[model samples]
Target: MVRWQVNLTVLWLGQFLVMGGMTMIVPFLPLYLQELGMKDPHEVATWAGLIFAGNFVTSFLFQPIWGGLADRYGRKVMLLRSGFGMAIVMTLMGFAGNAWQLLILRMVNGTISGYAPAAVALMSTNTPKEKMGFAMGTLQSGAVAGTILGPFIGGLLAEWIGYRYIFYITGILLFAASVLTLLLVKEKFNVKEASAKPKISVIQAFGQLRHVRQLPSLYGVTLLIQFAMLSTMPLMPLFVAELHGQTAGLAFFAGLVGSITGFSNMFASPILGKLSDRIGPERILGICLAGAAVLFIPQAFVHNVWQLFAARFGLGIFMGGLLPTVNALIRKYTPEGMESRSYSFNTSALSLGNMLGPVVGGAISGYFNIREIFILSTILLFINSLWVYKTLLVRKTSIEVNFEDERPR
Candidate 1:
């Protein structure tokens, strides 16, 4: 097997483990809080948001710094840093005596979160650019598959084995991921380049990206997509109940609505990725954004559980391509040697969206209702489609194409 192929395999499993381990706590976060002695539903809800938001706050701050370090040293080092750091944090969360302790531990976990971005940077640079869409798409499928499975397993284990032990199991999974990445993933770092290049400051790294054509717009789309997709998450169960109207197995149906997207996304990513390689990621991104916008509207008008599920599934098919398409575009336009820094900055954008989306969604849902959140998401995605068309797809005949055009290079 080729070296890049081996790296792709390890990174796939690595992504799967890290994502799965990270999400394993999702199903029972409220239960864990109960274990920490919060009986008030309001207090538990408040603490849940706090614990989750704190991590993203630190992660958004540190991603660029880690990205710069990845470029100076190697992306593989960043992967190990993230994998081991998360393993330690996951292990420590199991021992927290209070909600504050767990929240603080989550804050600390954010400081060292780089494994997935590191893997992307390494894979983007190592794999031939010609096949980058397929590679990134395949990598995305692993993470999507993990997301689909993690919550199910977490819920089951929380019932059978308990939440604390689930933390230990998640820690073990992450540690195994670190071990796999360390043993199987090889980096072709140039000793001369490492020694010769001066250390780059985080501010300097941001400046480097600003100069790349289409990169700034692509980064903007990262935030847009994440925010649009996640905005409805906090209200999903309530929406399900609202639709099902006191039906039996409400939680089960809600869980299916929540996760159905990942299943379709996992199946669609590689296929759309190959299509992107031929038609250009910019085109695929535009089409998907428009399709997602249209699909999200039906979700707002759904009269039955099946209608909701069908909408989410169709939405997922489009969601599958948006990020992979952006990643491919980012890889194509990013200047050589700046791949890690660029991807890291993009990851930071994603973290910001993850933090902001729920807040905005919660606010909108509070002000209006759960259904309005879908309309808001639909509007955001529609605006994003227009942005893609203007920034990435329009013809530019007068000036040199530079990084703007994805025409056969």
Candidate 2:
């Protein structure tokens, strides 16, 4: 048990470091593009949206492919590959001469962004069923911590030196993470199974969606939860700018908002996760959904930076529980062999939300006021929370009944 715990801890640490390094680039990317000759606000905004959307588009498209490969080959190998590939791509991004080059590199980075999925697969496979929630929650805390620290540090570096340096530093850190993964992660490859006929086709691989459909309420609730959670994302920078009126360093203010949210996630995620373990993931999830909705509504009204910070911090507390609870609920519904597929599908849903959230936010902000964007987000979240309660919490169907209902009558 101790050995297993140690192994999990190491994997978690590797994930934390990699995520920290990778996300650090996000807050600085727009500023970097501006420095690289695109000075127009509209151009910078468009490029920023493209950069953000591009990552998710590629990630969503390739996640299932990586999952299938992991199932066939091994999870650890995929982890190493993802880390190494991401490191190289991220480094090359630093040398990009134009916005187009940087956009291409971002797409490449997204294509190889399987480290977290791989790590989750590896950890879930090894962890005891009884302690799965606890373990996953603990792992999530580490990643959140990285997100909290990354932006602040990256923003500072970008301000003091240059934005390109942020990418270089992130690349080096990712490379170091890859090295650590290669050295420490151990997988028992199945020689006999490797020689056998392939068990699943790429199309058949997508058949895993059937499993999720069996738990429609769970799946729907999860999707809504993610949609609600991410709806506020694109407007964050704009919101910060409004709060920090006349601020000299807009990049720093953006970083400050990112860091505050991260800090809240860092502190709140584990506690909510542990609470989920104690009280139950479903109840915790429902409560978080409602709480986040309430908190986020107030964000649209904040007049000062400190007020925005407080609202975001409060929202982060409840929002932090969402992913872990969703994971736990999905685990409860999915079978062992299908866990990887289930997680991959969940990730794809998140990617879809990532794609839609920004587009929705950007569109709303483009035509209407940014504050209206938050109001719309609040409405979406409220609807999402109610949907979760009605679909998952209120329904008391067995897995088999749910499955049967989802099939042809």
Candidate 3:
């Protein structure tokens, strides 16, 4: 096999393992806190939210620093740093005696976690630009597949083996992925050139991106897309209960609602990615954003669990298009030698969205109801679609045309 193809193959599995490991125990955090001796229901809820949010907060603050280091040192090194660091921290979480210890450990895990962005930077830098969309799409499918399966498997294991053991298994999975990356992923790093490049701080690096047309807007689109998609996730079970009208098999049906979207997204990502390669990521992004916005309205109106399932599945098909296309566009617009930093900033935007989405969704649900959150998400996505069209598609600069010509026919 060719080198970039080989890199993609290995890193796809690496992303799978990393994402799967990270998410496998996430759904059971409240249960785990209970096991850790948090007796009060309110206390468990508060600690669970803190433990979960801690990682993203640290990750958002630290992503740019790692991105700068990835540019100077090498993306593979950064990938290994995150994989190994997360493995160690995650294993330590298994040993925590209290909620406080788990919260701190989760924060540390976030601070060290950059595997996904590092993998993207490495793939983008190594793969042929023409195939970038496909590469990114394929990589995304791996993560989505992992996300879809992780919680289900964790739930089963929680019934059989237990929670703390799942953490150990997660650690092992991360360590194995890092070892595989170390052994199989080959990076063609230009040491002297990297050394000769002048160093810049995180703020200055972002300032550099401002000079690159459409990159900043693309980052905003990344945030908006994530925010829109995830905003409804935390409320899904309650929505399912309202639709199903009972607790019987409620968990199973709710899991189905959640996993259905990811299944469609996993299947659709590569197809849309290839389409982006042909037409242009900017166009695919706009269409998908509009489609997702439209799909959200139906979700708000769904009268049954099956209807909600169908809505989420349809929404997932469009969700598949958003981020991979955004990543492709970012690569298209960024100057060489700054790709790692650029992707890192995009990842930070993603982390911010992950943090904000659930909080805003919860607040909206509290103030009004669950259905209104979907309506609000619809509005946000609609506005985001218009923003993307005005900022990116409408301009159609000569540089984008040139980039399109470079794609495989």
Best by lDDT: 3
Model 1 off-target regions past 4 Å? Answer: 395-409
Q: What is the total number of backbone clashes in candidate 1? A: 0
**Per the 3 Å backbone cut-off, how many clashing residue pairs does candidate 3 have?**
0
Query: In candidate 2, which residue ranges exceed 4 Å CA deviation?
Result: 34-41, 187-198, 214-226, 237-244, 247-254, 301-303, 366-368, 394-409
What C-alpha lDDT values do all the predictions have? 0.88, 0.75, 0.90
Clashing pairs in 1: none
Model 3, span 270-345: residue lDDT tens:
9999999998898999999999999999888889999998899999999999889998888888888888899989
lDDT of 1: 0.88
For model 3, give the 10-residue run with minimal summed lDDT.
394-403
Judging by lDDT, tell me the better candidate of 2 and 3: 3
Top-scoring candidate (TM-score): 3
Candidate 2 pairs with clashing backbones: none
Off by over 4 Å in 3: 397-409
lDDT, candidate 1, 1-409, per-residue tens: 8999899999999898888888888888988999889999999989998997988999999999888888888999999999999999999999999999999999999999989889989998898877888888999999988888998999999999888999899999999999999999998887568757877788987887898768888888889888987888888888888889787899899999989999999999989998888877888899999999999899889999999999999999999998888888888888878888899899999999999998988887758776787888888889878877887788332234655575676
